[model samples]
Target: MTFPKRFSNLPEYAFPRLRRLLDCHGPGGAPLRMSIGEPQHAFPPWVAGIIAEHAQEFGKYPPNDGTPELLSAISDWIARRYRVIVEPDSRISVLNGTREGLFNAALALCPEEKAGHRPVVLTPNPFYQVYSVAALAVAADPVYVPATAETGFLPDYGALAPDLLDRVAIAYLCSPSNPQGAVADKGYWADLLRLAEKHDFQVFADECYSEVYRDDPPAGALEVADEIGADPERVLVFHSLSKRSNLPGLRSGFCAGGPQSMSRIRQLRAYAGAPMPLPLQRVAEKVWADEAHVEENRRLYRRKYEIADEILGDVPGYRPPEAGFFLWLPVEDGEAAALETWRMTGVRVLPGAYLSREVAGENPGKGYIRVAMVAPEQELRHGLTRLRGCLFG
Candidate 1:
């Protein structure tokens, strides 16, 4: 049997790699999970009632793009949150999750070649793995740019050489990024959009953690693109209920872009995409419309932010997360720190290297560990304390 060589060089996924590295060691104290960014907060209690009310819809095929109601709700939320008007029918495609849109949009948008060469897909180092997989699936070269402290933890695509930039077909960016929790501001999005226009590439904005923010909401790609008056099809923004509403299992999200881009995305989805279940879409309609539950959810995450600051404030190189739930902490070596912390404190955390790839013999995430602050207040405090003492002490 033969397999495609496109994925031959891919590394083992983050979680299974962590298990292989740590499972042999006996933990020194009570185990606490601070590894995966699975939210532990309460989803709205009303969710159950909504699902039950729409249960019979399970017998029917769901709308490929989205139900008109669900799309309207999502567009209305965008208007309220981003202060931008979008026509739901032509601009948005409902997703099972942002991961789906992030992967599939590449398939639907990337050209066979750019500048008469195999197109390049740009991803930030220590990025969500799906982005790289999507590039490989299309036989494009996956170029990893470093998103380190020097670059504000977001990949600096503008810095690439002109020759390299011209070969680019798509660039994946995550604001309020996974693992690092760095939020890309208005300037960031504007600069990226401008670059896309000049370079003739599309920007795939993965803003799943937009709602898990603190203080002012992070500037969105949509509003920025509108302000700068760039091509609408140049940017596709992916958002999710998973991080926003603590509904990861709900698998509800949406991708919004210009008409042509969306047309292609939806067309591909019609043939290959699994339409989200009607029951879940019905529940998502309410979830997208309701901000009360979202407000309460943000309040909980704010407390977690405060707890993290109190516990890890003095640790050198510890930048408080601007948004999202993970703490990207610098250490001497990520895997070693994770092993020592688990053996000494029983706190499970992910080594940052697992989320990054090596280019030119260096993995930028090798010296950091990503800790997910998803547990309740007290438990989070316990885990942070142990992590501080075990790793920093």
Candidate 2:
């Protein structure tokens, strides 16, 4: 049997590689997991009642785009959150999760070639793994840009050469970035929009962690695009209920952009996308409309943020995340630190190098570890304390 050559160079996924590295060794102390970003917070109690009410819809095929009610709810939430008005019917497409939408949108919007050459997709080093895979799936050259501490944990796409920029088809940006937890401000968004307009490339803004923050809500891509009057299609923003409402299992997300881009995305989805089940869509409709539960969820995360700061503040190179739940704690070497931390304290963490690509013989994340703060407050405090004593002490 033969497999496609496109994915031949792909590295083993982050988690499996982690299991292989740590599972064979016996943990030296009580086991405490802080690896995956799966939220352990409680979702709204009403979620079950809503799902039960819509259980009958399971027998019917879900709408390929989304149910009218769900779309409107999502649109209304956008209006409330980003202050941008989006027509639910033409400007938004519901996704099983942002990951699926992120991958499929590239298939729909990326051209076969740009400037008569193989297209380029820009992704930040230490980025979510899906971005590179999406670029490869579309046969675009994936250019991994460094988003290290020197760059404020955000990729500087504007620094690319004109020739490289001209051939770019899409740039994947995650505000409130995963691992590092850096939020892009208004100026950052505006500058990026201007650059996109000049280069004629689409911006894929992964804003899944938007709702979890330390201070003011982070500026959004669509909000900035509207302020600068950039092409509506120039920015496609993806949001998820996973972090926002502690509903990772719900797999509810949406992508919103200009009509042309959305039309292409929706058309592609109609043919090959997996629509959210009607029962789940019904649940999502209600979830999007409610912010009380989301507010409570953020409150819990804020407490955890305080705990992390208190525990790790004195450690060298400790940067408290501006937003989001992960702490990108610096270490001498990621893989070695992870193994030692697990062996000494049984507090599991992800090696940062696994999240990044090697460029110029250097992996930017090689000197760090990513610690998820999603466990309960006290449990998370215990893990952080163990991590500090074991690694930084």
Per-residue accuracy of model 1 over 1-393 as CA lDDT, tens digit each: 999999998899999999999999999899998999898889999999998999999999999999999999999999999999999999999999989899999999999999999999999999999999999999999999999999999999999999999999999999989879999989989999999999999999999999988788999999999999999999999999998999999999999999999999999999989999999999999999999988999999999999999989999999999999999999999999999999999999999999999999999999999999899999999999999998888
Using lDDT as the measure, the top candidate is 2
Candidate 2 — which residues are off by over 4 angstroms?
none
Model 1 residue runs over 4 Å out of place are none
Task: For residues 291-332, write the lDDT of model 2, one tens digit per residue.
Answer: 999899889999998899899999999999999999999999
Worst 10 residues of 2 by lDDT: 190-199
> TM-score of each candidate?
0.99, 0.99
State in Å the error of residue 260, model 1: 0.5
